[model samples]
Structures are given as C-alpha cells and as structure tokens.
Target: MARAFCSSDDEVRRVQSALDEAQAGRARTLAAFAVTVGSDGAVAGLLGLNEREVRVARRTVGKDDAHRVAEALWERSRLDRQPAPQDGTPEPDSTAYPNEAPAQPGPTPHVAGQAGEPESSPAVDAVLTGAWHTGADLTTLAAELGLDPDFLAARAQQLAAEGRLTPTPAPDHTGRHRRMVEGPPPPADETTYLHWHQPAPQSPHHQHVSWEQQPPVTWGTPVTAPQHAWDGYLSHGQYSGTTS
Candidate 1:
C-alpha cells in the first residue's frame, strides 16, 4: 500500500550518487573475489587496484559468508569446464578405441577435486619452504610462478621466523635489508605543539569502530568502560582525530 518517493532534485542526486558508489563497490568486491582463486595479478591489474587493496577486499569477503559463495562459484566454473553429459550433450569419448583419433595432449586446465599439478603453476613449490634449488634464480622462479620475487623471499623469511620453514643454507637476503626506517618528524618544537589544538590520544579501539566496539573499547583494558569512553571522547587520545 506504500510507494517510494523522492522529495527533491538534491535528494535524487544523493540517491544516484549512493547507487553509483554501490555499483563501484560491487565491481571491486567481485574483482577481489576473482583475486582469491588464482586470478590475483590479472584482476588486480584490470581493476587498477594494488595488492593491499585486493588483500583487504579478500579479508573483508572472508569476514562473511561471501567467501563460501565465491568458492561455490569456482566449483561451478570447474564443472562447466569439465567434459560432462549435461543438457543432453554427448559425453566425451575417453575410451581408446582401435580406430578413433588419438587424444592430443595440450596444456591442462586447472581442475578442482583433482591431484593433477596445474598447468599454470608448478605444484612442487618449495620457495615458501626455503627449499628451492640452491643457487636457483628465484627471480626467474617467481616469474614462472607468476609471483614477485620479493614476496616469495619475504614469505619464506616469515615462515622461517615462525619455525615453519627451515632456513637451509639461506637464500640471499636483500629487500628488507635495504628499506629505510624513518621516525616521525621532530615534534614541531614543544611550544608549537602546545599552541596547536591536539586531539587527546585514544585507545586504538575508538576511532575506527562503533556500536559495541565503542562501549566495547574498554573490554580488554583494566579501566572501566565509562572511564575509557570518557577518555576517548574528551580529546584525550592522540592529537590526530578530527575535532568538532
């Protein structure tokens, strides 16, 4: 019995803007899902997104049931790619008949529920385990695996740090060693810092989250929730939050 209505041109414009934003977000999310299943660099390049954005989208998707939906979609695609008798189509001839044409082997397509090594990336991967061939050119290996050498090296190091990978005769350590560590700029001289209105430092919880996390901020702190809330709102946290 009710009809939707728009009040004014401004309201219509706002609705249209919101819809546009929603559509862009949907595209980004789908691109991110594609990234999760062997399409990382391709989807990232197509959508003009960097690895962090792709990873963030993937993590966001994992926070809900959407990841399962993506996995289902992958399975469906796998099924469609396989030879099957669907829609009354004839099943592929797998038997070696005496007179039939010999099966020509081509690059194998990726298949789920199978143990076959993928044609795209070699299955016997040892880069992450720090067991790739000694004196092997990892940059070339990364290219072959469609990965960045830096990332491969970093993951191996991380795994080693976690004691999951053994550092056998160590690979060459390069990138992280070269990165510069810069501390914050000098604190604008104490007088200038005092003159400027600085936001009170908040516990890490308050700025980014709301609802239960807001009242929820102090759940881990020894201080009471009221005290935490009071501290968070009273410009007591770090001097970075926007002021009213």
Candidate 2:
C-alpha cells in the first residue's frame, strides 16, 4: 500500500496564516492551544529543528515553523488512525509527541462549596468582599483566609464570569530577578540589658487573704550608675550621690 503524505506546504501555510489571524483576534485560546499542543521539545526532533528554534517559532508563530509543526501533527494523526500492516507489523504511535489538547477556556468548572452551590455561605461572601476591597492576589488572599489558591482563583474566575467581581491584571515582572538581601551588622558599642519582674511572695499572715484584699505593690525603675558610685556603694554599703 502507498504511504499517505501530510498536507502540502501551501496548505500548511494557509492554515497557519488563518491560525495566526485567529490568534490575533478573539479566538486567542484556540490559537494558543494549537501552537502549544505537542510542544514538549520533542517536536524539534520530529521536525529536524533545534529546540530553541521550535520555541522561537511557537512564540512568534513563524510561518515556516508553523508549517513544520502542522505537518508533524498531521502525520501523527494519520499514524494514529492507520491499522497494523497485513504482515503483523505494529503501527507507529503518533502520541509519542505530547499532543494533549488544552482545556477549553470558558466558564469555570463546578466545584464543591463553590459559588451557586448549597455549600456557599457567609464565609465565601466575606472572602469575595475582602478580595474586592483589598485587591490582594489569589495566593496572598488564600493564605490569609486559609483556603487553597487554586480554589480561590477558580472561585474568583467564576465570580468574574458572573459579573460580580472585576478581574485584576497580573503585575508585569519582565526582566525582574530576585536577589538576596544582606542586613547590616549590629552596633558594637551599645550595651543592652533585659529586665523581668518577679511576683511578690505570699506572707504567712496573709495566706488566707484573697488577692483583692492585699496591699498595693510597688515597682522600682532601673537606673545605670557610674563606676565611681558602684565603688563607693561597695566600700561604704551605700550608693554615692553622684550619677552619670
């Protein structure tokens, strides 16, 4: 039997052009899916192109690269439909390249305890309210509310779809990289001390008396004295009048 070839170069170019135009238009999700399907670097080997080139092609939607990818996908699909040879030779598997279709972008999936469900309660409403007022990101809000980020994101998307919440655009972090922060060392000349208060012991005579009937206790302020004052106190059993 004659081998079936893939689409012609002109046909692939026409399809790719259509896809590019659609991608630029409102069908952005479909365009992204088409380009990203079977995008696991292995497509480079199948198309006899380098991985970098394949990546560049996917990003820019280059005509040549698109044609090559489309041809590979078509061949893969054809191989999948073809049966084994009469001689009992196994057919080639086209799924060797990851061609998994992306999920259709539309209404969020129904989740337990999500909006519109019986499980939805005041807590959900409060979270949605806080999210509206603070404009916090999903991860931060999830952490603060002790909820899953994925669940929060999905719920937010659902609310946005329902016209109850406005979706905020993610911040652009292009060309921004994280760096380690080194704090300054502590001061060497400063002397620090910690003070703790000990509760007064109960007197034998007042052992039966409640705390409310006890006399008021006094607390003393800590002061730093000069070295001369300490020496005088140690020698005379009394502090000197001088203080620094």
Report lDDT per candidate.
0.50, 0.51
lDDT of 1: 0.50
- The residue-by-residue lDDT of candidate 1 on 100-219, one tens digit each, is 877679998856322532322234234434333233445556667775554455444444455554323333333332322222234467777886557567676774553245321111
User: In candidate 2, what are the lDDT values of residues 119-210, reduced to their tens digit?
Assistant: 44568766765655454444555568776654554455555456665434443333212211223324334233221233356686665566
| Residue 114 error, candidate 2, Å | 9.9
Q: How much is the lDDT of residue 70 in candidate 2?
A: 61
Off by over 4 Å in 2: 1-120, 166-244
Which sections of candidate 1 miss by over 4 Å?
A: 1-6, 9-21, 24-28, 31-35, 38-42, 63-66, 72-244
